[model samples]
Target chain A: MTDRTPGTRSSSGYSAWRLIAEELRAEIGDGRLRAGDRLPTEAALAERFSVNRHTARQATATLAEDGLVESRRGSGTYVTGEAMRLHRIGVRTRLTKSLGEKASASGNLRVLNSAVEDAPTDIARRLALDGGKAVRIETTRSAGGQQISMSTHWFDVSRLPDIATVLRRTGSVTSALRESGVDDYVRTSTVVGARHATASEVAVLDLGQGAIVLVTEGLDSLTDGTPLQHVVTRFAAQRVRLDIEHPRAD
Target chain B: MTDRTPGTRSSSGYSAWRLIAEELRAEIGDGRLRAGDRLPTEAALAERFSVNRHTARQATATLAEDGLVESRRGSGTYVTGEAMRLHRIGVRTRLTKSLGEKASASGNLRVLNSAVEDAPTDIARRLALDGGKAVRIETTRSAGGQQISMSTHWFDVSRLPDIATVLRRTGSVTSALRESGVDDYVRTSTVVGARHATASEVAVLDLGQGAIVLVTEGLDSLTDGTPLQHVVTRFAAQRVRLDIEHPRAD
Candidate 1:
């Protein structure tokens, strides 16, 4: 039993199952156990660790509960790894382009509110507009039929006079911009931050209060460097990971 | 007085102070009120908003508690604007190079533990080590006299023997690598994620139990593209924003 046992325990005591789970978790983290790999049977794990069947079952259960594994009714448990989709943000990030096939196929946008409002002073500066007011569009974006982000966009109203109407028809800012005669845009800057979701975010994104929201404040401009849009997007942190690329540095 | 009031109150009904705070928060978020901008005086804000001084004070107090503003002795309140430092991660992210002058001058690393241990399977693969064992170093880093991050690093011992000794003398992994005859390396990939601080992270980083930690799991390779290191660093999400740049994308 001693020879078969793996992992060293420190003097500070942990439960038998917990130690087993930690060792396995490290294996998963390190890459010994990969996604879709079947875990050993309870009896085999018990025998290898010199623990009882109950402990082995508990260890696998812990891993499953943590979303590291899945147990089918007939088939044995298998590693799931992260299981979350990777969203890449590059110099030219398009929501449709960055998302995976399933997300891209099912991605939908709902305009919660759209109006020509007094542009916040900063938004005015970013959009390079003279007036205090600009067009504001609040939207909830869903992917794979689940709400993923709440985005508030500010645009210079005079430049895109019928943006709200165009956005309503297109259900996409990029498409609306294209209709407005702006063919292409690139991300100029992005400030990435995180904060607890506000009550409205909790409701809009269907997340718990205090859930982490990955906040991206970004500016996008025309290919000619004419600023076009300033957007603030709050993403459900658990559901998405923002991959930001800094192209100029390389 | 009520005629001067701004912002539409939701059905849930917020206090005058909260409405004021929200508007100010939006302004700050949009970049109207930038860092070091002195806020309007309490009397001025109360007059402009048609609210009492107490309400204005409450708004500023709320912002202060949220780390958006700071009150100095005899000096007016100013927008601190997030207060947290931005730590940029890129193809060649060096802690000293990424941090600002204050952080760079004061930043320190404390070795929590160093040992030759079974590399987590994923880390083993990242380092291209055939053997299961690797050198592990756990550390806590601080700047401006506050704990900032807890990092766990794995290195293939065969490639860089006595790394711990070199790290101890240099207090920097990059320097230790240089000492080991590896002149330079670059980040290959980074996985950015966030989760509630673990117990050990909370204790080591001096954070509340449920505080968020921004995690980056990454691998570094030599200029010639030989994998050299796998590191997992967790930053106090409230205190630092990881600015990732995709150098190759540009």
Candidate 2:
């Protein structure tokens, strides 16, 4: 709040309201303002910025347009939860770890369906099965009662026949793999892309059809170099930001 | 192609048209069909898939809907250049390497604008230069005459006073940094997100307003751990996919 008065459009020449909005955005970005915290009243903001109430309202309006804040009819404007959740992706990236160990109790995996089917060409090629059959699992993962991602995972049924059963019991892919005697696996490659959510994705993720979905296609291989699984995950972009940690080349 | 006859709905129970589209999509995905390659005519596809012309037409329609192919009317449809350019994100990832050395002559960075201004709060904080002035460079990178990304970069002006001059001479950030006598740098962090393109982005990227843009915010630091710059790049979703290579923990 260091004199964010936007004095006469210093160097950047940004309008006063725009500067105010930017300051608020920075506050949220840097954690000075947390998600869902109600902003000060317009009068307070105006007095602080040495501006009129109308100017303060304009700033809030700008924030709303950026999906950073929400205004209530009777209450003050509050920051939206759009600061975004950072999902770190690494060689050993684990969804469970990213979601947090404490979240496990409150989170659950809903297996929409499971079936044995001829692997799609892309999945088949990635898994090196070449037209072989695989177990396809459609699942939605939720954390703290909020939907996080919808994923379709394909695994060669020949290698792990009891995955669905184990998954159902454990609600954990790692646990299921361990039960199936996989021991361990590591992600070999990940292809990240983005697209507008489809109709089904919109309904499944409870997001707008036009919303963006961060698509990740990953291939995991066992320590012995045997391909184990190929998965496609669609993450709600508004809620998740992918943090890629590149290892140092020593 | 692998008897993609669709056989009046294979074991998966997908419709003949859907199976046909899947087969074609696979061909494109697997590099069998290249961008700009003309797809088989409806009659040819009908004969090949053992379906009627109507079914083949429906398949092409589905591909068109998915943005995998475009109908050219009178002429056969062509595979859209959406097979995706994989941009690897790693500690030592280089844009030149991702775009390929062969593309260097064809790919060029077009400087849209540059200005010296008080650093925006978010950029300032990321560069650890709050309230400091920086040089902002706006650039659009093109490879083989097609726009790939639009990036805005901020660097401490005090450290690199002649960045704009060097950038203009070399048309590369790395080259400019080298010219400014800053030898080595490494990416410390990268945050990847996505959102619908804005009007200006839609125009610049030649995409629809609702088209997705892959946003990456990255920080680079000197080898000695001093922060050097912050950059925000928006990539056209349809044109690029980020390949994240996680180092093997041997």
Using TM-score, give the best candidate's number.
2
Q: Report the CA-based lDDT of candidate 1 relative to the real structure.
A: 0.72
lDDT of 2 by residue, A22-139 (tens): 4565456544687889998989988888888887888788667546689989987998874476777877767876765545742477788899989867678878886668999999
lDDT of 1 by residue, B1-75 (tens): 322464333322245666566557655654567899999999998988877899899879877865779998899
Backbone clash total, candidate 1: 13
Candidate 2: list runs displaced more than 4 Å: A1-69, A100-102, B1-68, B72-75, B105-107
Candidate 1 stretches with Cα past 4 Å from truth are A1-83, A105-107, A246-250, B1-82, B105-107, B246-250
Question: Which TM-score does chain B of candidate 2 obtain?
Answer: 0.72
TM-score of each: 0.71, 0.75
**Cα lDDT tens digits for candidate 2, B160-218:** 98898788778888888988998779887888888756446656776532356788888
Displacement of the residue A87 alpha carbon in candidate 1, Å: 1.3
